[model samples]
Target: MAITIALAGNPNSGKSTLFNSLTGSNQYVGNWPGVTVEQKTGKYKKDKEVHFTDLPGIYSLSPYTLEEVVSRDYLVNERPDVIIDVVDATNIERNLFLATQLLELGIPVVIALNMMDVVRKNNDFIDIKKLEKDLGCKIVEISALKNENIDKLIETAKSVAGQKKMTYQEFEEDVEKYIKEIEEFSVIKDNPAKRWLAVKLFEQDEKIMKEFPLYGKETRRLEEIIEEAEEKYDDDGEGIITDGRYNFVSNVTKDTVKKGRKGMTTSDKIDRIVTNRFLSIPIFVGVITLVYIIAINFVGGPVTDWVNDVFFTEIIGENFRGFLENAGTSEFLTSLLVDGIIAGVGAVLGFLPVIAVLFLFIAILEDIGYMSRIAFILDRVFRKFGLSGKSFIPILMGTGCSVPAIMGTRTIESDNDRRMTIMTASFMPCGAKLDVIAMFAAFLGGSWWYAPIWYFGGIMAVVVSGIILKKTKYFSGDPAPFVMELPEYHMPSARNIFKATWFRCKAFIVKAGTVILLATVAVFLLKSISLDGHFVDFNADPEDSILAGFGKIIAPIFAPLGFGDWMASVATILGLVAKEIVVGTYGVLAGIGEVGAEDSSMVALVASKFSVASAFAFVFFNQLTVPCFAATGAIKEEMGSNKWFGLAIGYQLLFSYTVAFMIYQFGRVIEGGSFNLMTGLAVVVLFIYGYLLFRKDRSKLENKNFSNKENDEVVKYESN
Candidate 1:
């Protein structure tokens, strides 16, 4: 039989490091299943036959959070042969709580005391024998990062998998009585040491109770015990169970562990400074500014430009155009390769360097555990606007792709918060948007700051919009309470960091190749086809051409926003396929042949018609609009109904239009003159939005039945 071993611990417990060390496979390292939360797993490299399941990192088995529930279900249902519970040796007291519950599952377990180096460095000591005696499990010391004693850990786990199962730690008199009573009805009744199941039954885990039915008297008996304990504990039965587990761990630690008599250490001292009440925010801003400067201005900008111009433009451009010229390729085929595919998707691919750098930094922050602090620091301020600090993660991820960013909203517990988060997450500039922003920056703004400015603008958009929406009837709610564990920081592995970079970069390429390919082909088809003796797109006036004809029909609609040019209209229409395609569409319409790095021919054409303000407005509109088709699908799946999906899309479009109108009108007004009477109508719309934004309460939209129920509850409770 294969020796099955499960690696388990709290988030950032070096579980991933240990798994990678043992498995040598980078199979799993995504933000989350449907959220920005990280997920990881791998199999042992040394012993492929020895199955290793890396369970999600969680604090405990209580179903208080989604991750905890998912983890608990896997452990209970899957029932691995042996569990190697990795404990952060430095934070043993807290880490042991999970281990204590794992012991109760009645599976053979070997405790891997991780971070022992840190423990020894801190002048702390844990009597391994004493700990083993107290917890009734084998304990092995190992440093997951340095790969020390890792082999010893695997050997011990293999040995234990072949060994007989161990019994759970005995509970207190009252807890033990209920344990016995519930065990009588449990499917694992033949095995009498299932202490945690009994406690879960007493705490009224519906899933557990359903699995093990009992007589009326027995059922009532369990309920009576749970109710009486709840009253005595002054908390819910679940809370009581949690308290019991922690208390048990505390007792075990008191005898075996000792801390050196010392003042605040280096880590604590640094934490005080970094996490300071007043200094943290400003410092964080400065840090972010510095990061952007390094990423966009210094590193990513030059490298991306090189990739765009040299690799994409010179190399790919020359070869593709040469092939077309040599083969006597048809104007349609030439345009498809040179304009549609190369220009559209290639434009987006140009910014891969910039995205890689940004994602690398994000991965580092996450691995080192600083990202959680970001949430904690922002929680209080964001709460006033009906969003939790947790909303920041999705917004941050949106800088890479809105598809995952929209999905990240699932982590938000409140349906209202989740919906609002989904609506706004994509407002932040993603990798696809970065290409457009980079294009404008290089071609229009003639400054490096422009790229970073777009990112900054996207972030500010979400925040300001969040604040406005919070006061509206549609978005009224209190932010969820913020509670999270701060894991001990560690130096991130190069392997893991690079793996993350590849993961995000791969997503970008996939979009460029697949979705953008289809969209470009569609654009080619639409722009080609017959009319007169001419290849209409190549020879005809842009206005009379197929793309131009469609744009002309919609051109008047966007005239108010200052981009009245038909090409701008066409680009916006193409944006429905993908946001990045707008830049590519510009290349095609400008009659630029395989647009290269040195080529500003198409950009000049766009500039002749559009002012800087109008260009910014155009970018802004696309940035905040209903995201790419993939994100829309994610919204539909996550919302789980078309009505809610429509609401999400409608709200996004409405918000995007409102902001674009404001920027165009307000900026134009300050610049003075050439304003039309329709500007007055836009001004009126702006006023209504202002009322929605600044109003003390959301009264106008509160009557809608689909308004967030959680937010309604919060509004009602707050009023009381």
Candidate 2:
């Protein structure tokens, strides 16, 4: 028979590291049975008969968060043959709460105490024998990160798999009374999860109550037992149970663990300045600005300049055109292949170096554990706007891609909060938009402030949107509580950082070769064909081409925000397909097809046609707009309906246009142009924004108007 093992633990306990080690490359990843939460199962590399399931990390076996529910449901329904409980040894007291609950399910469990290296370094010692005696389970101390004693851990777990069955931990006398009665009177007396079910019933868990059917009088009797216990403890059932578990964990740690003198660690010392209430926001802003400066201006800029100026413009374009013409190819086919596809795709690929640097910094922050601290520092401010730091995490995750960022909102408990996060998370410029940002920075002669301004401007938009929308009736509510474990700071792993950077850059390069290549060819055909359907030379009568006529029809819509020319208008519209293609479109329209067009490059070409005001507005609009089709599908899936998806897209477009309009009109005046009608209109837009920002919160209204299934389920979920 195949032996199934479930790995369960709290978040940040190094459970995933162990899973990766045990499974090697044999893992299979997919969704949970009926939910969107990810599920990972793999056959052990050493022994295929020993299958492992990596459960989502959770604090307790309660249906609190989606993760906890999925874990609890799997443990109960599947009843795996054994469990390896990965516990963070440095924080054993808090971690033991989950370990205590896991014992009650009657599955044989082996506690794999992780992070023992950190414990040893801190001068703390834990007695393994005493802990095993108290918890009545096998224990092994290992470091998942260093792969220390991993084989020993699995061997011990296999020995305890079916040979030993551990009973639930005993409670204090006061609580023992209710438990003894539950064992005698419970309906699931013969069930495998009898003890666990009995405890859930005593805690008055609604989900658990719904599961085990009890008639009217039987339910009232159980309620009486719960009420009496609550009266004695002076706490609700959930509180009473949670306190009991903590109390037991406290006793176990006190007896078996020896601690060193209390002093702040290095991570704690750094947090003092970085997380200081008054200085944190400014310090965060400074750090991000410095990162962008390094990536865009210092590190990635000179290389990209060479790629655009020397590589694409000099080598590829000139050589490819000459060779094609020499081979007796027609001018039309030669231009279509070289000018249309090569120039456009080359324009986007020129910025790949910058994206690699940006992704490297993102991976480093994640590995160093500062991302959690950033979220922690922002929680107070986020709460004031009817959101918590939980929403901000997904926004940070959007730095990679918007799909997973939108999907990350599932962990937020409130419907209003989840919907708001999903709507605004894409406001951040994803990896796809990094090229557009770099293009603008290059156009400005590689100005250091250009990238940071565009990057942080997107974050500020999310914050400001949250503040304004929280006042509306449809979204009025208290925010979801944010609970996160801030891990200790450490040096980033170079291997992990490079792996992350390569995957993101690889995806970008793949898209450039396929989607972007096709899109650029289509653009070339449109611009080369005239209104009467004959091929027209772009060097002569470029305005009479089909693309120019089509762009002319939609150019007036964007006139208020400047960039009313056909090229800029067409680029902005095509960005909806993929943001990277915006830079490609500019390359195509620059007329790089004609000889001697080399020195007047794409960025140089665009700069000659646009003033500073219109160019800045063009970049800013793409930064805040709905990212692409994939992200839109993510929004629709997470929002659960066409109505909410439509609202999200509508909000994004209107917000992007309004901000771009202000930037253009105010910027024009700042550049020494006299105030015009559009400048006065910008003032009116600012006044409307002030009204929205200062508005009072409205009462929560019935949400029956919009059909959202997640809304009803979220309302029913208990927030713990």
Per-model lDDT: 0.75, 0.85
TM-score of each: 0.86, 0.92
Output the lDDT of residue 718, model 1: 100
Model 2 ranges with Cα > 4 A deviation: 21-30, 42-51, 184-186, 216-224, 231-236, 315-330, 538-541, 591-600, 700-720
Best by lDDT: 2
lDDT of 2 by residue, 451-569 (tens): 78876888889988898878787667778899899888878778767877888889899999988999899888999999999988756656888989999999999888888888888
Model 1 ranges with Cα > 4 A deviation: 16-54, 120-123, 143-152, 162-164, 173-188, 191-193, 202-213, 216-243, 299-305, 319-336, 446-449, 467-475, 521-534, 537-541, 591-599, 698-720
Flag clash pairs in model 1: 31-37, 473-698
What is the Å distance of residue 516 in model 1 from its true position?
Answer: 2.9
- Candidate number of the best TM-score: 2
Model 1 lDDT at residue 92? 90
